[model samples]
Target: MSLLALTAFAAAATASVPVHSVALDHRGGTYKVDYRAAVETRARTIGMSAGTRPSTQRCIMTATVSVDRIIADGGHELHARVPGEKTFTRNLPGDCRGRAEQLTALVEDRQPAIGAHLAAAAASDRQHALAAIDAAHNLASN
Candidate 1:
């Protein structure tokens, strides 16, 4: 049906495109980093068997990581925290004036699993949409 087709098309379109965002926040003497991630899924088909029948469909995912905003805080102490983690403070090597990059790195180090989680969620949604489409197709053919 048209509804099924629309659902599949929407899922495929969303999986193919990468989202982008931009924001600016002015703050005095505070180090802040706004990180964003966009995940895209690609369907890879391996070698086909005899009679040109499709063997299997594989979902390969890629993530685009972006540092949306990085504001430098003026001080000698740097604080970094990620979701589900405790906040940690570190002393800057020389001074707190040029440690924005260091702060960002410190925070990013604890966020490597974010892309994986996003990919899994996307894959689950894609699978559900695909199942719905298949069910609809079978019903229509019968």
Candidate 2:
């Protein structure tokens, strides 16, 4: 789940009284996963003339493109060729199974880098969280 999704879930959870504490489970392993048959859509207006009414002249063009997303997990680290981007996707219109196999192979090739980057990011987040906790404790003591 994305961070925004998690934040929304947390908000909803806090709004109601829960009988038990929430636990988020994560799987730890080296793996490559691929999701295929994803669709990408883009819309744009075409043929706009100053003499013609905008609404009448406007045309919406849409195309459905098949895409596949691949991800590599190296325990705690993750690095991708596209810096600052979490996912790697490609346009592949083919059998889902075949596309997945190809995508997995691609992810496996970059697994090492992905793992390293993810680990660094996780460590940074952990450090920041600890610092925030320490700051809160010190403030409370004072």
Candidate 3:
């Protein structure tokens, strides 16, 4: 194959693969995780326990991530590479699985940074709450 043809083929293959995108929903005040297929797993899910904000005052939110492999050929077996059998096998699309190692690394890489930022925010919120109480008490006494 000519070099130009090979380059085109590589670009096409790369374009076919999905990319991971993760962000915090600051405007809506929600925590959501989105990821592309990993190296060994597809449909990587990163989430937290429902109802706990990462910066929720007085609580530390934990990120829960799992990589799932979808069963092929009209099967409904979903395999978890990170959750360790915690995820019940459900119907999943074939294109979901990618690389488990990559997803794991993403989780590990993000958790600490997010935790630190949220920790600071939570502390600030706590301080504000305490100050409000103090101001209210002083007003009532006066």
lDDT tens readout by residue for model 3, 1-142? 2455334333333332332323333323332222223222122223333455452122111223233222212222222222221111122222222333333344445544434443443333433333433454477689
Worst 10 residues of 2 by lDDT: 16-25
TM-score of each: 0.25, 0.28, 0.23
Sort all candidates by TM-score, best to worst: 2, 1, 3
Q: What is the C-alpha lDDT of each candidate?
A: 0.33, 0.34, 0.32
**Model 2: per-residue Cα lDDT at residue 114:** 48
lDDT of 2 by residue, 32-86 (tens): 4332222222223344355555433332322222223334343422222222334
Residues 77-107, model 1: lDDT tens digits: 2212222212323343232323334444433
CA shift of 117, model 3, Å:
1.5
Q: What is model 2's C-alpha RMSD?
A: 16.0
- Which candidate gets the maximum lDDT versus the true structure? 2
**TM-score-best of 1 and 3:** 1
Tell me, by TM-score, which candidate is best.
Answer: 2
Q: How many backbone clashes can be found in candidate 3?
A: 13
* lDDT of predicted model 1: 0.33
Clashes of each: 1, 6, 13
Model 3 sits at a Cα RMSD from the real structure of 23.1
lDDT of 1 at 1: 19
